[model samples]
Target: MKNKPNQLKYLKYQKNRNKGFSCRRNFLIFGNYGLKSINSGFLNFKQIEAARKTLVHNLGKNNKILIRIFPDKVLTKKPLEVRMGKGKGAIHDWVAVIKPGIIIFEVKYKDYDIIKKAFFCASQKLSIKTEICYE
Candidate 1:
């Protein structure tokens, strides 16, 4: 599924300088288990989709999966060997600015071992380190 915002107030945003730990979405809310990020980074849409697919493939269809993060920030890139002083580059990708202690994915399942394994596989597809958390 596409995870980008349909409309944004600003087309491009400034570089992300917010390094503070995420205060919101740090706790499990919708599910019994979750994958919490350990480091701060930008998660692109492809990585997010890969992780989601891995989770779904490992967990099967009966389980419920909730994606906590969305790629709202736009990343731009200049064409190869482009001249300087050409303003901002065109939008190349979308990413989610993630911070430490943020819950990236949540799952509601009865089996702990299965959930752990699925989360492990999903974490492997992500760019940041993640630990499985349960409530």
Candidate 2:
């Protein structure tokens, strides 16, 4: 058996060699984060409205955001299963495209919540700084 340090080195080498840019860590984190949103019931109309209000209050009255709420499958254009191999799979949640650079997301919900989740997720991921009003 290899020593602990040797094992760690071998693992790192394997990750860098094979996985390289095709890593699923980000998607995994996204999935878990999404589960938290679901368990906590964060995907609700009121929460969405609050998010919208927050964006409007902060971004001002002129900023307009295009929001699209759909299944993670639709969002990623891939399967929603993380273990599907190779493919990053769909976002499995909401998808918000803020133009330029930003993709807000949520991994659950199949209704209006998707729209809201996408906007919020994109804003957070992109660090938009300003508010994302979806009105």
Candidate 3:
């Protein structure tokens, strides 16, 4: 079955900069490579899962990959031909409201080249722009 969130507390949010790079107290505390978001947008769980799968499949089990963001915010939608007067919509999917400078993924390994290759595959799965950062 396709992945879907079982429940969500709310449907809409304030779209404020409530979280960002400043909140990550240990952004570089564990990884050598960080996947930083260059744009702000909602990232679906499926997209993150696909990117993570690509990283693990290419990098194998020796290295460690950490997913920093999560798809917690609920995004609702209506049917294609539905009437316009309905109340908002039902919960259709879940996503993470990513902001600029937020680290989406962190990779830790000894080989920089391998890290770059793995990140390259993963980066293609995202919709918004991203940048590779190292420490």
| TM-score for each of the candidates | 0.96, 0.25, 0.82
- Cα-lDDT of candidate 3: 0.79
The full ranking of all candidates by TM-score, starting with the best, is 1, 3, 2
Say which prediction, candidate 1 or candidate 3, comes out ahead on lDDT. Answer: 1
Note the clash tally of each candidate: 0, 7, 0
lDDT, candidate 2, 6-99, per-residue tens:
2222221211111122122123222212211111111323334445455455444554432232211112345444465674443333322122
Q: Candidate 3 at residue 80, lDDT?
A: 91
- Give the Cα error of residue 29 in candidate 1, in Å: 0.7
Badly placed stretches (over 4 Å) of model 1 are: none
lDDT of 1: 0.92
Quality of model 2 by C-alpha lDDT: 0.31
Best by lDDT: 1
Task: Quote the lDDT for 40 in model 3.
Answer: 75
